[model samples]
Target: MPVNWRLKLKGFGPFDTQLDWSMSAGSAKVAIYAGNGQGKSTISRLFRLVENPQIPFPSSLITTGSAKGKFSFTVGNGSADLGHVEVDSSTGVDNQLDYLFHVFNSDYVRDNLQSRSYSPSGDIEGYIVGKSNIDLSNERQSLEDVKRKGIDARSALSKELEESKQELVSLGASRVKEFQEINVDFLMNKTVKEDCYADKIEQLKAVDELPDDAQAPDKLHLDDSYLDLDQLASLLERPYSKANFAEAFLEKVRRDAEFIEAGMRIQDGDRCPFCGRRYDEESRLLISQYDSYLKDQEATVIAALKGKQAQLSRLIDDYGRLEAQMLRGSSSYGEMRRGFDDLAKVEFPVLATTADFTTVVNAVIDEIATKNEDITLCVSSEAVGRLRDALGTCQSQLRDANKLIDELAFNLGKSKSRKTTLRKDACAELGKRIRREHREAFEEIASLRSKYRLLEEELKNKEAQSKRSKKDAVARLMANLLKGVFGNRYTFSEADFSICFKGETLGKSADSVLSDGEKAALAFCFYVASTWELINEEEDKNKLFFVIDDPISSMDFNYVYSIMQVIKNLQDTFELSRTRVLLLTHNVAFFNMVMGTKTLNEAWMLDEGKVTEVKNELLAPYAAHLRAINQVANGAAPSHTTGNSIRQILETLMHFEDPSLGTLGDYLESDYGGRLNEVAYLHLICNDQSHGTRTFGYAQPPMDDSTIRRACNAVIEHIRDRYPGQLVTAGVEPSENNSSS
Candidate 1:
């Protein structure tokens, strides 16, 4: 389906202008023109409205005070008769203006286009992108079936289990009649005796709670305070004042003896001088003085004794206190010792005292010593109770066993019932799988058909694209065909256009790898391939026009010119100009290269929002002036010679800092071709002019040309050999020989 849209705007700011356009049926490329911000892209968005109608019109386009304005477009078959949509106010409502909106829908599209439905394209996306819808429907159904069956199986199993449990409960009560006379009394007595031993063991544990020696308050007090009289005495003798007293007494005795001597001498022996008659009156006086002296000395001795006694008294008092403390301490120690002895007496033997707990135990035991004929009472009540407990435990075990049996029976029954249900479920699942698989198979067939159609469509478009590309590439190749092989300095015509190469074939066609400028020619062949494919697809006479926008931006000047020449050749050879050849550029040199006196039909300069025509006379004068100025300037300097025979002229001109005519000429030629060609021309000219010089500098100096060539050639040869038959070629070597062009 093809669609056409026309838009008019009044208050839309930059997009206020009106434009009328149509996307001729089957055409995908749309060329837009204008400087930055001129609304060139706005027109492209209007076409998208048919594909998606939700985008609101810009507010700028709305009339003042008018909430909205209408946006209308026609979509349908090849003609504009399909329908038109007028959107105003609310954005999404589709208002059929005068024409009905045309929608080309097949039954498949209708049934599969809804959200709940799955189209082949959507299904394919699901398959590849992993939101698969095919098995989801079936899986949901099977899950529901399985859940229902599981519930039913559980219910059946539970019912069977309940029944079995009830039966076991009844049977357990009936088994109680067999063991009625089991002795329980003896068992209880034995238990009580065991309990007594346990209590005794508990009592024995009390010894651990007895006060330790170090912690006993009384004992500690005794140790701290106790002392005997002997100890008191020893304690008191530390200074030995008694011996000192005795020594003092002896000294006093000696002093008394001295006094006696003095008295006897005064009384009995003759005193000299004034005492010559000492026998009479002085005898009594001497005796009296001696007596008084003795008495005073004795008093002194007694006083010394009394002082000694006082000292002894203090020591004795201290001793008494010490003795009292020692006795108190001893008493405390004794009390602690007694307590400890008593505690020691509380030792418990490791084993029980009675060898057999029976003798002492039997006394406590209530025996069941009874006998009867008809119903034998063999065991006591205690034994009977024990037997009853054991029976109860056994009954519990039997109950558990019965419960397990019930569960097993229930499970078996449920399993049997589930087998039938599983079969039915399996049948249902199989049916679902069949239906789903059938639908899928049908869908797969439909998808394959749709894919084949889509691929066919794509192949046609791709082929046309490839063909156009090849045609452009080939035309460029043909125009620059001669430049690839012959020297640029020499003149050559189309008749002399020959391309030859000495290198190995690089897998591409001859035009492709023939030279550094021939790969585009080979690629051009594929463009033709594409054209053929497109031609085979549509028999309609409609054709496409290509408008290149800065296509040669990456190409050097020479290449750009060569591409223009190719464009011209294509226009002439294929009659492509009848449709259109809108080559846009900002480069003056490029404009000159393509637009000549008669080569181009018309020249348009874009200004404001309109196209203005330019004349050849205007372009011609610019070229003429540039050429004349370049020539006279060349003559004034050295000649543009390729021979080294002109070196003296170069060196002389270079001697002063004035520009050499050779360098000036080279710089001028760069405007025509590019720096790459300029350098090549310079190198060749330099080589020729310096032919006899020892070193041309441009040449390989004294080194082996073969060695450098060999190293380069060897690498190339090695690469070719390593890849077996692989070879590579360049199209246009850039100024740095980067080969982008």
Candidate 2:
């Protein structure tokens, strides 16, 4: 599963208009050893593009003063020569290098080595730096099994569905092309298959063509919000009394009541209003009877009867409107009868008919008019009950009609676009007809499709479960790795995903207490542990690539061996075809340690923009120190770890001269050449930088670039003056750090 890759990049950081590199197939393990500022990190950035070409590989990565820069990557036997990625143009790449290369760089450190923040209630939530988890291999395996089954089911279903479709076509069924031509809304948002192939097929088959000659529905429309008639009946039939008078005298007086009443009001000082003469006592007393009749309950009765008359008039107009609405509904029903045969014949309610309502209302009006003329007449409760009963019967009938109308309305909605709807229905019916003719093929297709859908759902659920399990597994590994590296000083909690120092959680204050080397070790342990995500034996058959960039840059000697052991374990665990670790580093000591002697053939030195396969001796820490000193003497600014290289050069030279001297400061006692005070200060500078003891930025400021260059030049001169033969023997090609002198 080893992949062959060729990369050509132009104008990309410290690379020029020409930077081409290739990895041969079967060359799984490789190294790019370089000094710190020589741009070896660019290799990691290039590796990232294979996974995601659109990651912010911006113009800033291009060297300055270039119009554009392009890179081409050939993956998997160079047959897949993915097109150029133009940083300025934003052009994309297409490649088949699918080997999962887990990259560990500053970017990865920023993303995955999570920072845990605490809440107000003392609960630690993450983005967590540490993990709490269990081994989830079983869960992961189960998911893999489910995924395989789901994929297989989907494939089988696809084959069967195609076969069924062809069978239907042979059996004279319409092609789904026609279904696609129709507007999607016609199916009310259903898929073409569901609309044409499934439930609707049966309904359409039962009802072949549109029905003609159907009867009108039993009731066209219902107005459940009808008025109450019981109150009206009570008002109409209530009893009233007139003045106490003889019947014969009442008849005459009732007609002349108004005239008689006016005469009585004018009877001031016994003067008559009827004639120009004063009224006698007998006439005055007789006219007083008219006033009594007008003021009595009989007057109230007449006013009440008139009110009832006005209500009846308004009822007549309302009844007419109700009739018009009913007529319209009946006409609509008759029209609908021409299509939908399920509609029942309608016999509209009398309450809905304005004529029937008017008849009942008019009868009450005429009766009330009679009572107004004769208030002495008896109030007939029987007649009132009879009229009320007729109105109540109409109200009940209207309600019954409303029920039938609702059912009819629902059916009519379906048949509104009768011709077009029936045609579509008939098409579905044709599908049903074809299925009946070729039942075997159709059933097989349906069965497979159903199973496929079920399998897909199961696969998704299992995947979710497995993803959670994998995180727990990563946490389990992280806890073991941290404890292994730092011992009891740093403990990782699987329960809360917290990294604690001496039983206390390390938050933002961790940097103040822990050394830079300790922090680097924690991050590296986590990075090595997180590679478990790619450990899928069942699904991923291809090899995995681990591109680790500068894993131990800032580490001290105490923690360096532990870091080397973790990387070694990582190599041993995912061995041979399973993994390919391409480690890029500036630390010659680290490179030699990790590669050992067996992997020297895979070691390559990268300088400027060129790569050359080098021997094991080329990466010696002694030679590396000499190079750093030379670069500084030539006025190059020193890198963060350059002080360590400087210190190693002096310490190795002085010890080679006489192993009894423990420190560079002891050189003063030996009467070495050059400034003795300057040498003592240089010794102090090297020790302070090489050992990260004082708080960062708390000690004296860093030596200026000029002072560092002069100090480095002086040390090189002092080395030449004392031990000139050692540099000639050690050579420019590096060798491992030697302590057996």
Best by TM-score: 2
The number of clashing residue pairs in each candidate reads 32, 7
Model 1, residue 543: displacement in angstroms? 4.0
lDDT by candidate, in order shown: 0.34, 0.60
Cα lDDT tens digits for candidate 2, 548-648: 88878578876888877776666564444344667788877778876774442377777657666665534777876886777787777877666777778
Score residue 396 of candidate 2 by CA lDDT. Answer: 74
How far out, in Å, is residue 151 in model 1?
Answer: 39
TM-score of each: 0.25, 0.49
Model 2 TM-score on a 0 to 1 scale: 0.49
Which regions in candidate 2 have their CA more than 4 angstroms from the true location?
Answer: 1-7, 22-27, 52-56, 70-89, 114-449, 455-468, 487-515, 534-541, 556-558, 575-578, 597-601, 640-703, 710-741
Model 2 weakest lDDT span, ten residues long: 116-125
After TM-score superposition, the amount by which residue 8's alpha carbon in candidate 2 deviates from its true location, in angstroms, is: 3.7
| Top model number, lDDT | 2
Q: Which residue segments of model 1 deviate by more than 4 Å?
A: 1-503, 507-536, 539-541, 549-565, 569-578, 586-600, 607-610, 615-618, 621-741
